[model samples]
Target: MESQPILATGRLLLRPFTLADAPEVQRLAGDYAVSATTLLPYPYPDGLAEVWIASLREGAERGDAAAFAVTLARGGDLIGGVRLQIDAEHSRGELGFWIAQACWGRGYATEAVGAVIGYGFSALGLHRVHAIHFSRNPASGRVMEKCGMVHEGRLRQHVRKWGVYEDVDLWGIVSPIRAEIPHPLRSMPV
Candidate 1:
């Protein structure tokens, strides 16, 4: 659940995002570098962050998604958010995340994604969990890879941002008990 606070990783904490986190979320995620990687835009407004926080709360209760604010465990500083969308009927889920500019290159994304994926598999009993990111954000691709999701394919010109279309690389992980083996992406040649 989006509003439900979660335990932090050794390096990061995934917390429930309330209306209070709006300002910090906007400040961190509203930057050009941060927003460019995700679907959000630069110069985000005051109320936009509040809306997003509320959306997370609403989504979680409605079972549309489970999202968390990524924070530093020691200082409890907010940086970004990670999401998991559950498809209970199929026993699958989708993973997504965005970290602030200041936290870039610190492996915070990997820590957060790995924790969430573990929650997906162990807690949610999901048969499969997947993710995708813009090709422009190679670092996120690395996060997915490091989190054990294999790069399945690239969807060409699949998403339009600002005025142009962008490509996205799809990635996924699943239970080895199923018909296929769960390949930890660390072995991939990519």
Candidate 2:
């Protein structure tokens, strides 16, 4: 696959990460509130954002994953990120996202997620897009719900984070059928 394509939505834009975004990525993703809910390591480590951004394009090229920087449509300010980890053989992908704590409750996560799911099913030909969130964070689950993903199930102590085990809630959406309907014909007298 080539570089990930830019995805635009009504209120936001989803574009591939660039090295120039590292500083803001670190500033937003480094917060304890952000890192605590995500897989990002705490204290966020120096240069890690740049390193991660640098790896994204190659991963996209290899069909392994695609990560996008979520930004405001009007000002183009980086606010967060969303990613899809692909499973080509199964025609599926796992969706993950994080918005800065300051940007939470603004519907940004839900909007960004919807766009990515659309791209996954329509552009990438994915059959299913799924997501999992730490059970403690119902807000993330709410975002998934708003995007039309159904609650699949929950895994008890499925993830160990910050030296503690956390339950995970799984959610998913399958591509909807788009077959055309046949037009009705006039009936002839028998």
Question: Scored by Cα lDDT, where does model 2 land?
Answer: 0.91
List runs of model 2 lying over 4 Å from the truth. Answer: 177-190
* Model 1 root-mean-square deviation: 6.4
In the range 19-89, model 1's lDDT, one tens digit per residue, is 98888888888889887878887789879988877777777787767888898988889988888988988
User: Which pairs of residues collide in model 1?
Assistant: none
Model 1: number of backbone collisions: 0
Q: Which stretches of candidate 1 lie over 4 Å from their true place?
A: 1-5, 176-190
What's the lDDT for all of these models? 0.84, 0.91
- lDDT per residue (tens digit) for residues 36-139 in model 2: 98889889888999899988878898897989899999999999999999999988899989999998998999999999999998888888899999999999
TM-score of each: 0.87, 0.92
